[model samples]
Target chain A: MQTIDWIVLIGALLFIVIYGTWKTRNQNKSVKNYLKADDSNWFAIGLSVMATQASAITFLSTPGQAFHDGMSFVQFYFGQPIAIVIICLVFIPIYHRLNVYTAYEYLESRFDQKTRTLTACLFLIQRGLAAGITIFAPAIILSAVLGWPLVWLNIIIGVLVIIYTVSGGTKAVSVTQKQQMAVMMGGMAVAFTILIYALPKDINFSNAMSIAGAGGKLNVLDFSFDLENRYTFWSGIIGGTFLALSYFGTDQSQVQRYLSGKSLRESQLGLIMNGFLKVPMQFFILLVGVMVFVFYQFNASPLNFSPVATQAAYESEYADEYHKLEKELELNFEEKKLLAMEYGLASENERAGLKEQIVLADQKEGDLRNQGKEILKKANDKLEIKDRVEINDKDYVFIHFVLNHLPRGIIGLILAMALSAAMSSTASELNALSTTTTIDLYKRNVQDKSEDHYVKMSKWFTLLWGVMAILFASVADLFDNLIQLVNIIGSIFYGNVLGIFLLAFFVRFVRSNAVFIAALITQVVVIYGWWVDWMPYLWLNLFGAVLVIILASILQIFLSKDSN
Target chain B: MSPETNEKNGPKIELTWQKVFTWMLVANLIYVLIFYLIMKTFN
Candidate 1:
């Protein structure tokens, strides 16, 4: 990175921190102001929700996902709009009417105190672990790419978020997210434009589309009922809806985004905005990645996108084997490039023959890349620090593009954008964690506490969670599989919680005890399911919700029989 | 702030919500269609 890059990166980050802290600095820091600071317009709520959900991974890894796997990942969001509408219709009005700080608080009203506390603890366990990865996901990726130490990067992201978040609490999170969204989207848009212009002048957008089509990169929908497939249209709608419902309706991070709205209507409208725009936003990001794939098609791409992995491969005894694979990759890329250009220029009829040839060439390239990955893995066996090196290169592709391809200031801006995404989400998680802890646990158990005392405690708790998150991120490498566990942590708990909420909302007769016991059983079953690899982790959300609800109903009937 | 609408603010929230929801579902249908179109055109 050049001097201009450093200036842009540091300048943008500092501006967000100072702006967020400055903007909410004047709030009186009452409990409402500190934890549930309302008065966000719909647009602000929309952006906050979007920013909170889109961690650095969304920016860093999603394009890579598209680059390799194409746009079928967009199907993962098909359930989003449906989830949003359901939340607006049922979840928002009740939360508004009851005036709760966190989603778990509603359980106490509908069920008993134990159920609420149980759900709150489940949330703390899942989200607290996830908050660590919210920082570490980007830090590890950025550290590897930039050769920066991971500890410093983790602390930098965690502390930057803590500064503004602890300064003003919920309002600070909502306020800073607007600017964060702007930077993320603006940086992506500018990068996309530059990428398009970087393509060969003869290849117009239509011809570029043709090239992508020939490479089988433009696929957007898969309606198959294959349970083995993760992103088919059916799984996306049925399973995705369950997970999103758990996320938006029951998860406090997202729930808090709309809860900060100025009014019930504002909150509803805010969610509506998210429902409508989430898919298109994801589609646009995936489109940028497809363009990156196109960019690489014309340019010479490495056998592996991760430099450290490639370096390790070179350093190992397998350097000769790696070099041979690289040579083959070069030959294959040259052939694909020429074939791609011809396919781009080919007419409608000519494209079929060219597309078939290109697909075969693409398959050969993939086979070589697989061989390269095998060599990289074998090379990694010699590394002293095995966990830090990512053998798979999916997360590195987009950043690799930004670093080697983009001009100076924009690189910094894009890096800043990714870091800001990390900060934006971490701030929201800390804010929500602090709020749930203060309201659901502390205040609920220790009654008669003054709002001032609770508010003070909330601020301290935010700082505490933020520090823990940084600590987790710093030591993340110790647990080689921690990232994978954290990724599924939310879905594991989400199913039971969503079921409890759905019972509360719909099943009037299932009382607190039955629902509470059913939730506990469902949780144990869900954990066992995850342990056994019962199905894909995301489907656990659907399975858990259904299991808990059915168990609760059956228990309710049996308990009623006993009571009679 | 029209005077007639101002008087209806008490119950104003949900009158248009169902309509909005219906339209929103329609929009999702359109999204599916557009995605299908992309697949059909490109793949």
Candidate 2:
């Protein structure tokens, strides 16, 4: 990036941090202030909730996802609005009534202490690991593009987040998040507008979309009930809804957001706002990707988009073979582009005649690209199985375009947006993790401490989790679809967690032992079901909830009869 | 305030019809505009 862009990027980031710290400087000194912002209003809590969920993975990988996979991924959010309604009606009132710091606190009130501790431990494990992955995912990309060491990049991002988060706590997270969301959305909008203007003259927006549609990149909805297809409308609605419910309702990272509201109504409004906004925001991000896909059709894209892989291939023995294939692919793209343009301009009868020929040429080009991928894979296998492997799927395409094609200052802005997403998400996770650990585990089990002591311990826990996240980020591999990976990790535990909460809320007759044992069995069975591939990941949430309720009810009846 | 008084206040009702309707309208309008833009630009 140019000096001007670097200056702009650094200035924007520094301003956000300084602004957040300044705004929250006089925040009260108590556990309530640190964890829940002492019950703030709708706007602060609302924006923080949104920013926490919109991680670096969403900004970095989403556009690339759209570029490769098309817009069907938006289906994954179809169930979110419905899930929001459910939370508002059931989850919010109960949480407010209990006056708990974490969602698991309610589990303790309704069921046994064991159930509460188990649920909290599950959250810590899943969220703690996820915090690390969130930091690691973007750090890897920034390292690759800027040639910085991954370890240093991880520490830089993680430590910056830790400083503000440990100092200002929840108030800092909420305040900084408001600005982060604005910058993230504005940067993305600018990037999308620039991408459209950069397209070729003949390809106006509509025509470009038509080309994308013809190439099957505009398939946004699928009603198929297939278990294996990850993003079908059914999976999104059913599986996605359960996942969203568990996430927004039971997850402490989200619970803590609403808990900071001055009233229950404000928190409900904030969530309802999220429920309504999330789907469309995702749709727009994915649309930019579809446009990127069309842009690449007119331009000559690389056989592989990963620079590391591409560089390794170029330096290997297969360099000459790869070069020859690249030249042929370039010619093929030129011929296909001409055919597509002719087809676009043709009259009805003329179009009918040319359609088959155009499709045939397109198929041939696709096959040639596949052939080139195979060559790269083989060469990579020979060079070093671990280091030289090329696993380029669809998610790397947009980033590759941005780093190579966009102007200097815009590049820096995009990079800052990515870092902002990572830092915001990681900071929220660390904050939530610390709150759960201190309140659910330490305060409850250890010697009762004063408010000041608990507050100090919270900061120490935040620092510890932040360091742990940096360590995780430095070591993990590049996940192809990071958003999906994070959700999948959540699904494995969310079902059981949500199940425990369900039992606590509705099944009053069941004793603590029954519910606890039922949860353990449900978790094991759900893990087994997922391991054996009996159902897709989304169904696991539903399974976990239902299994715990049924098993707990039965166990309660049987155990009661035996005691009598 | 005592815990009983806090409970009697019943979580402080802020759910005004005007506010709810305003948010609903704003949210729907935003969705419509997004769809219009996508259809206009990409269709």
Candidate 3:
């Protein structure tokens, strides 16, 4: 990055930290103020909620996902609006009525301490692990593509979050998120505009989209009932709904965002805002990725986007074979470019003919790219690094565009956009993790503590979780994709927690013992199901929630009869 | 019995539960149509 880029990146980050700390410097003297920030308005709460969920992974890998697969992934959020509606009607009122610090505290009132503690522990495990992955997601990609040290990247992101979050607590997370969201959206808008202008003059937006459609990136919604498909319309609506309900309803990370609202009306309105805006915002981000895909069609792209894998291949004995694939790929790109130009001007019938040619050319290029990956894997196997480097190239696609194509100062702004997203999410996660730990675990176990004492403990716990997240990030490895990995982690545990909350709310007779045992059995079953790939990860949320509700109700009858 | 209207300020429901829900369903329908049109126009 040039001097201008550094100025933009550092300047944006420093502004967030100083602003967050400055805003909430004296407001957090009590547990309620530190943990809930009960004065937050609807807009701050809504932005914080959105910012918490849209991590660096969302900004970085989502476009790559759209580029490689298609826009079908947008269907993944089809359930979220319904989920938010359900939460507004059911979940939000309960938490607000109880005036609880964390979601689990209500479980204690309805069930027993065991059930509440059990659910809180589940959140701690899932969210604690997610906190690390959120930091690692952007750090690993930026480190790989920018040649920055991974450990330092992790530390820089983690420490920035820890400073503000530890200083001002929940209020810190809320206030800074508004600024971070501004930087994030501003940077993305700038990137999108520049990308459009960067495209070939003849290829207007419509033509560019046609090229993308011919390549199959515009298949936004698939109504297929196939269970094996992960992002079908049904799966997105049903499975995505359950996931969103569990996440926003039961999970303290999201619940805490709105729990800070100045009034019940404000909190509900904030969530409603999220429900209204989340899908379109995601669609816009995915469109940016689709546009990047269109940009690459006219330009030369790497055979594989992963820099480390390609570097390893270049240094190994397979270098000659890799170069051969590169030459073949270049020739293939030239052919496809010509075919695309023909496609741009063709009539309806003629366009169909050109699309077939374009798809065929695209398939051949994909085959060559796969062949290149195989060679790179073989090359890496010979190296001392082994599996330390990722061979899959999807995560690297968007960052590759940013570094290679975006202008100097804008590159820094985009990088700031990425780091801002990282900080916003990690701060929320760390803040949530610490809040749950203090209220549900520490304060519950060690009673009669002063308000000041608990506030101090909250800060210390935030620091500890921040350190743990950084440590986990430093050692974290890439899975299929960073975004999916975080969701999969949430899916594994979220369904069970959501189930417990559902039983507490809707089924009044299901007592603590039955629900607790049912949750244990369901967790084991869900983990086993995920292990064997029972369904796509999204459905796990539905599966776990349904299982717990069913098992708990049945167990409640048996246990109640026994007690009588 | 609706959770949304069970408030002391309950009788003055500004955005009624029914209306808000209808809006959600309607918005979703519009989004689906727009997405389908984008697909048809390009493909």
Candidate 4:
């Protein structure tokens, strides 16, 4: 990045932190104002909800996900609209009626304190770790591509979030997210524009999409019933719905966003807005990745995008093999580029013939890349650092494109976009984590505390969680895909949490003891299922939720019979 | 703040809950159709 780029990146981040803290100064006189924000309108609330979910992982990893995996990842959010509608109609009203500070507080009123505590602890554990990953996700990629130290990158993001979040509390998080979201969306729009404009002149939008489609990158929906297929339509709508329900409806970070609304209608409308905008936002980001994939068809792309991985291989005994693969990749690229150029001008039959060649060439390239990964793994072992570097290059695709292709000023803006996303999400997580800690645990257990005292405690907890997230990010390792890893972690716990809330809302007859016991059993089973790879992670949400409900009902009947 | 109204403190939309939900579902269906069309057209 140039000096101008650095200026833009640092300037944008500083503005968000300073603006947020300044705007929300003197606002946290009480616990409600500190943690609930207490005055957000529908629009602000809507953006805050959107920003919280679209973490740095969403920005940094998602396009890479789409570039490699195709647009099928979008199906993961297919259930969100339905989830939002349900939450608007069911969850919002209850949360508003009770005037609870945290989502878990309502659990105490409906079930026993144990059930509430159990659910809140589950959220804290998952979201707390997720907070670290959100920081680590962008930090790792930016560091890899920019040569920035990973630990410093993690600390920079964590501390940036902490400054504003700890200062202004929940209101600060909500307020600053509006600006961060603007930076994120605006930066992405600019990047997409540059990518499209930079595509070959003959390859208009339609032709570009055709090239992508021929390579099978445009497969947005899979209607297959296969559970093994990670993103089938059925899994998206069903499993995705359960995941969204738990996340938006039951998760404190999201619940707190809407709960800060000026009124129930405001919160409901804000969620409805998120529901409408989310899928398309994701679809557009994936489309950008598809465009990047198309750009690489005529241009050179690395056999492995990870610089660290590629370097390690070059420095090892497998260096000759790696050099041979590079030669093969160059030759392969020339042939594919020629065919792709011809494809833009081809007639129907010719297009079909060229499409086959293009697909075959793509497959050959993929095979070569996989071979490169195997060699890199072998080389890593020689270096005594086996498994330290991620073999998967999916997360590195977009940032590699940005650093190598984008203009200097724009590169900084994109970097700022990444930092903005990281800050927006990490702020919400720390804010919500602290809120749950303060309201559901500390304040609940230690009563008769002054309003100012609780507010102070909330800030301290926010700082503590902020530090914890930074420490976790420093030690974090690469998962299969950073975005999917975050979701998998959530799914492991969300199902049981959502099930508890579902039981509380609908199954009025089931007492607290029944749910408490069933939840424990269901949690163990869910973790075991995830451990054994019973199904895809998305389905874990359904499995855990259903298991909890069924077990709780049966246990309730058994308990009643024993009492009788 | 009964179930039907739930403390209606903002500007009222004329659409009922049933209608709003129908619209959201219909929008989803429309998006899915567009996705399928893209898949089919590209294939």
Top-scoring candidate (TM-score): 1
DockQ for all candidate structures vs. native: 0.37, 0.16, 0.43, 0.51
| Prediction-by-prediction clash tally | 0, 0, 0, 0
Report each candidate's C-alpha RMSD, comma-separated, in the order given.
2.5, 4.2, 2.7, 2.4
State the TM-score for model 1.
Answer: 0.96
Best by DockQ: 4
Residue runs of model 1 more than 4 Å from their true location after superposition: A381-388, B1-17
| Two-chain DockQ for model 1 | 0.37
* Lowest summed lDDT window (length 10), candidate 4 chain A: A379-388
The C-alpha stretches of model 3 lying farther than 4 A from their native spots are A347-349, A381-388, A477-489, A525-540, B1-13
**Candidate 1: lDDT of A239?**
73
Scored against the native two-chain complex, candidate 3 gets a DockQ of 0.43
Question: Compared with the true structure, what per-residue lDDT tens digits does model 1 show for residues A425-476?
Answer: 9999999999999999998888887877887898899999999999988888
lDDT by residue for model 3 (A455-513), tens: 99999999999999999887765343455677787888988999899899999999999
The Cα local distance difference test for each model comes to: 0.88, 0.79, 0.88, 0.88
Q: How does model 3 fare in lDDT?
A: 0.88
Per-prediction share of native contacts kept: 0.47, 0.13, 0.51, 0.53
Clashing pairs in 2: none
What lDDT does model 1 reach?
0.88
Better of 2 and 4 by DockQ: 4
i-RMS for every candidate: 4.7, 6.2, 3.2, 2.6
Residues A423-514, candidate 4: write the lDDT tens digits.
88899899999999998899989999799999899989999999999998887754444556777888889889999999988898999999
Q: Which pairs of residues collide in candidate 1?
A: none
